[model samples]
Target: MYDHRKLGRELGLFDTDPLIGAGLPYWLPDGAVVRHSLEDYIRTVERRAGYQHVYSPALGKRALYEISGHWAHYDEDMYPPMDVGGEQVVLRPSLCPHHAVMYRSRSHSYRELPLRMAELGAMYRSELSGVLGGLTRVRCIHLNDAHIFCTLDQVADEAAAALALIGSAYRAMGITDARYRLSLPGAGGKYVAAPDMWARASKILGEVLDRAGVPYEAVEGEAAFYGPKIDIQVGDHAGRESTLSTVQVDFHQPEQFDLHYIGADGARHRPVMVHRSIIGSVERAVAHLIEQHGGAFPAWLAPVQVAVLPISDAQEATAARLRDRCLDADLRVRILSAQDGSLGARVRETRLVPYQFVIGPAEADDDAVAVRLRDGRRLPALPAGDVIARVRALVQAHDTRLWD
Candidate 1:
């Protein structure tokens, strides 16, 4: 098994300092590059899907989670309410309660039947010290979260649409080795005992999965406190399945929080809410990518896409010019000065970068550079302008390939 923590450390992506506390990741510059790129990609995908982005506070009053039933149902995993100037508050563990409050912030009409709200929310959990493992299990998390408040008649379609969105994202990320689990309330006290609501919501979710042509296994006792959910399990390089994405249909929250919308009849009616996270944790996703691809990220997601190496001090000017050109073309690149390392040493370092180029007297005189790809394929000298344009297109298109 490829251990992401070890790989991440070796790749200089992120670090966890014991002094700062366990499970908190501090992203180095390289890691931030990848993190920012992934967030941008997700935002682009979400905006195109009609999601209205929003930001919510990271902490809330204890009564907030109580209203959402998390305090009662999931207290063990949550930190005890903190005393902030005599007021008891909690470091938010989930984005649902805040989002629910946002939904209740203003009255809504039936026209806003499927009001989808999203956020890059932060959450805190009280994981047992022994149980905390890298990004997968953590105290702090940056959640890629969203909530859809819809009418009962719109729930099924909205559920199906959520599944489609998750499926599209997985496909785009080349995550094909996965399965679905439809989790329902089981024999545990973990779930809220709204039996009638559970039956209705579970049936609706099952129907959505069936209509969407997705295969799923019914898992007992895995549903959230609010409702039933469809959790997608993606396998790592070693085939160990882990939950990656989820679409949770919430029934208890809407009723508990009294979230409603004006119907066509001008009467107040409860709006059902669905909580979905296509990418559960940005930190965990980076960790997963590290292990999945052995830290050799695709061109679009690699921290450093290209490295420019000068053959000798004589080629320093050419390397400098090429570096400027790469930057002007918006390519995430670095130039290897002669003082940095030997040409051979720098070439070996290109394993971390998808593409690398060598500039020397002949090539510089010809206004060209010799290219080397991650796969050890060395190509003939090509014009600097042509190389710049080629890499830019690959980056803009999010191409996985190192070369066109």
Candidate 2:
């Protein structure tokens, strides 16, 4: 079992200290590179799917969640509201409330019924210290969250599409062990007091799973307060299961926020909200990737995609030149010169790097580099331009291979 907490520290990916508090691990430089790449990939995918991105403040007026029903049901997991200029405000625990307000900010026509809004936004949760271990549970989280506002008639198709999107993202990230779950409302005061709404939402999610022809377990007591959701579950090295993605059908928030759109008949109609998250929280997603890959991430997600190693001082100048060209090509690269250590030692040090470009005296004179893959495969020394272009193509395509 590869524990992320162990690999994270050994790889210098993230750190948690007493001063920073528990459940608040800060990302190191390498970890930030992985996160930035993941964020960029998600943005591109969402944009291609027609989602409009936005940014909202992390703090919200208490009334915001109150209107969204968090104040009434989910206050236990929320931070205490602070009085600001005689008005109380709180760190948002979720982004749906703010997105609801954004949707209400303008009148919309039915043509735009399925309006998709996405945000790689930050939110805070007041998790108990005991349950907080590494990134799986955290006080602060940046969620790849999005909400789709559509008509009742559009709910089924929109929910189905969201499920398809989640599956596609999982496959791209090389996550193959995830299972589907139908999370329904269980007996609790945590759920909203809308039985009809719960029934409708649960039915829609169950059908979505069935229509998609995926096997899933219908579990009670695991749903969000406002709605039932399709949870994408993955197990860790310790066999502990956690949710990594979700697609939820929400009819309650729209009613709470009075969100509406104009129909062809020119009458006002309430919109249904479909909540979806592709990778859930960035921290947990990276943590899972660390364990899944055992710190040897896919080439596209590797923190340092390439490391240039000069066998001797004779090759340092050529190595630096190659590094500059890689940087110019927008590749994540670093030069590991002979001064650091022997060629073999340097190669072993950056073994996790996807590609190690070793510049020997012969290769430098020939204006080429010998490529060493992370998995111990080797490619003959080739022209610097060929290596750079191929690596750029691999990264841009999100390809898993080191070369063709």
Candidate 3:
């Protein structure tokens, strides 16, 4: 099993200090690069899927949660309220209520039956220090969170599309062993108050998953108080399971919030809501990636993709030129020619990085580079253009684990 904390430090990803408080993360420069890349990738996918990006505040009025039913059902997980002027305010624990407010901001028609809104939302939960583990569990989290406002007629199709998006993201991350659990409220389960409504909602979600051909396990009584969900779970190297993504069908919130839209029959109707997160939390995903690859990330996601080395000070200029070329190609490149070391010693150091480009008099004169791939293969000489092209291709493919 991989030691995630050790790997995180060694890779210069993130750290926790006593002064920074527990269950909080301070991302280093390298760690931020990975996080930013992930956000960009997810945002691009969401944009293509018709999601409109929006921002909501971190703090909300206490009554917001009360209206959303979170105050009644999940108050223990929330932070205590503070007096902002005469009114009480609480740090927002979830984004759904805020999204609902946004939905209420404007009138809607059946013509816009499906409206998708996404946010790289920052959320806070009062987690106990004991449960906090590096980036996996933190008080401050950025979620790849989104909400789909759809008519009852459009819910199934929209749900399937959301599932497809999550699957594509997992595949892009090279994780293939993920499992899906179709969560349903139990007849006598924790929050099952209406058995008939629960049965109908469960059947609808099951039919949607079935029609989509999504293999899933039915989990009875595993849903939240408000609704059923489809959870995406993945096991870590230690055989421990974690939820990586979720798609929830909520029937209660819309009614509670009195959200409505004009239908084809010219009547006000409550729209159904679907909540999704392809990567549930940014911090959790980072932690999982650290363990999954054992600190060696793919080229596109690596903090530092290439380290350029010169045999000696005499080759510094040539190495700098190669580094510039790589930078121009938008590759993360590092220079390691400060110390007087043998080429073999330098190569060992370069191993710390995913890719290495070695330049010396012979290759510099030939307008070529000696490439050392991550898998211990050394191409003695290759045209500089060819090497750059290959590296770009590999980066595009997200082949960061190893050259092989």
Candidate whose lDDT is highest: 2
Q: 89-198, model 3: which lDDT tens digit per residue? A: 99999999999999999999978879999999888999998888788779998999999999988888888888888878887777677888998776653473666666
Cα-based lDDT at residue 43, candidate 1 = 88
Greater lDDT among 1 and 2 belongs to 2
- What's the best-to-worst order under lDDT? 2, 1, 3
**Candidate 3 colliding pairs:** 298-400, 299-400
In model 2, pairs of residues that clash are none
> Can you write out model 2's per-residue Cα lDDT over 167-200, one digit (the tens) per residue?
8778778888999999999997999989999998
Q: What's the TM-score of every candidate structure?
A: 0.94, 0.97, 0.93
The CA lDDT of each predicted structure is: 0.86, 0.92, 0.84
Worst 10 residues of 2 by lDDT: 165-174
Which is the winner by lDDT between candidate 2 and candidate 3? 2
